[model samples]
Target: MFNIDLFPQALKSDENGQTRSCLLQQTTMGESVTEQELWFAYPMNLPMPEDDDCDSYLLATLLPAMQLRAAIRVHGSVSHELLANLTELQYVWSKWLPERYFLIDIQVDRIRDQDLQVESAIAAFSGGVDAQFTAYRHATGRAGYATRDIKAGVFVHGFDIPLDDTEGFNSAVEIATQVLSDINVDLLPVKTNVRALWSIDWEEYHAAAIASVLCGLKRYAGIGLIGSGDSYDVLLTPWGSHPITDPLLSCGNFRIIHDGAGFRRSEKLIILSSWSIGIRNLRVCWAGNKHDKNCGHCEKCVRTRLNLLLAGVDNPACFDTPIDSSLFRFMVLKSDAVRIDWSLIRQEIIETGRGLEWLPYIEKVLKRKSSPKLSGLFPFGSKRRMWVKKMLMRNK
Candidate 1:
């Protein structure tokens, strides 16, 4: 059996900021690896609470435990509500992806009760389309009663921007800070090494990692808003973050809400088009270049440009160069979900009678066939095969 031991360490103050860490020791199949640390660092002025619980560590390590079929035993306090919610969360995951993931056992020494105090919410902000939509609606009271009072927008350094990319992270943070500040929300920069700890699939592990970060910052906010990538009409199953599973990550006083799934990417962009601050400062590229925030050549950058153009914005300030219509010829959408996004863009262009010049390129993207290997593997159609196709498309 796999064993996971959680040991909370004292807060360390360094030149960068205050770091709260937990030492994770994993042992499996008669082999062990120690010295792995899961930590979150905040600015000097942001003081973290003294809550000595392993909830964050448990959430962060859940995917690894399931992969190893490990029974997790925490040496520190964990919330009873979180443990109970995890049962349902695992049920959803195992049900969706039976081949890759299954339910695992979890245990803890002390179970803490919920905090009765109420506090404002915090959102995971990457300066992307979804995140900006969520932040803008709530800040402008467009969400009405369902709106959350977001105290701060959390910009995680290690998620999109790598831990070693200190300069890139700081630069991106500056842009995110400015955009959030325009909506009257403060920016909280956080750093973590959870992704480096394991070789798990990032598509399945990212939400858990984000939840762990939010849980660790429960001292500052009670509610966490994870922006949704797809709307209800085009929901993608077996995804890391979804409207169904995001709420299950909540524990006791901390709540996770998946926001902005009601509108499509193009629809959301249309609304955000009016928000000048968000439009100018959007940073959605994952090209790994330190200097360029949005490389117009990448698939994501090209997609965002198309979305912006459909929304009636041309040559957005966030992108240095305009998207080339011919770029669609070489682009292969990695997933059916992304293909659907492009299809929706095409439909929007047709319906609005705008951006008609780019329809042929969008059609080229839509007409492209699936990988030959995938077609060969799933020649005999079945429910299981269809699900497998969807899952494989994500990784392809």
Candidate 2:
């Protein structure tokens, strides 16, 4: 168990740009390396918020990174193998290993102890719908596929999620605790004072950056990179980009399995709506007002509301907020709006019509299947099962 209690409450930056969160007692491990120190500082793509919501866990989550400073007097073989692939090993350990250690304790049917194991699963569990659904899907199974070899765990990083809002992380943690109730696992929390660094607007591929260090340092199978996928796939902004779209942007080492493509944002909401989720507990606004609830007027809130409405799901107990129809209007007016060719996409969805409209486009973008193009300029991805999938999606 990686104990985070010993981590310091504050840290200072050096002239060379290395951030040390613990001021009083400098880390006794990995002191000299540049990348190691950065990981120890804060394993987040964005700057952390300096506020009440920030706590020791953020500082502690940087422990693997903290090991770079120096070895504390703790006695054990520190198999830094975990450093190479944070998410994958995390999955390995949290999900597979425990089941290996104690089989009778769990409700096992398909998974076997001899099949596989992970060091741990990388997780910054946010209590929102997408995160919840992703975790739930991982736990339940994927398309009738039992996760006999898979595991889930949370690796706390200190960055405040709600654009500097303190309670943003707390709500996420609280909800995550409730959601991960069945899966017995450890919360490897880290405390790193990294609020200032996350403030920078242009962060492209922090997941890859974080996962690489975890993979390189650890001898785990790979890292598990989790993302809703839709946020980046749809939104093009000045500061951020989607992990799936730009895997090459960061240092690639660990195998990142982003569950973004498992389902659409709308589809997730539709499925989640059917299940007994504490819908009132979800928060979508990035504005950092937990008490204010989901501002349905905001772009994020409106998107969720629209998804639920389209799916014909009941609205949960909502705090007072209005959905702005104009936002959807403006969003849809785009040249590449999702329904810009509703007719085109719609025609492809018919029983006789193959889902060629967006399926091909999605396949090419997701690198799910390969297409023949003119030159290197045109990307031809590997086509896994072109006809069968098309038949299924089109109801053919």
Give the C-alpha lDDT of model 1.
Answer: 0.81
* Top model number, lDDT: 1
Instruction: Please identify model 1 stretches exceeding 4 Å from their true place.
Output: 31-35, 369-396
Task: Write the residue-wise lDDT of candidate 1 on 126-228 in tens digits.
Answer: 8999999999999888887889999988888777776767888888888888899898999988988887677676777788999998887787889999999
User: In model 1, what are the clashing residue pairs, if there are any?
Assistant: none
Error of 2 at 12 (Å): 14
lDDT of 2 at 105: 12
TM-score of each: 0.90, 0.46
The CA lDDT at 303 in model 2 is 45
Candidate 2 has what TM-score?
0.46
Tens digit per residue, CA lDDT, model 2, 1-396: 112222233333554332333322333235422221223433233233221111122222332322232222211111122222333333332343242211111111121112122343443344456655665565556426523223444434443242233465555655555546644432333333333232221132234333332332222333454555454434432212244222322112223455545565656766666455535555555432342256454435544564554445445555354443343432321123333223322332343243233233322222322233222232111133233334543541
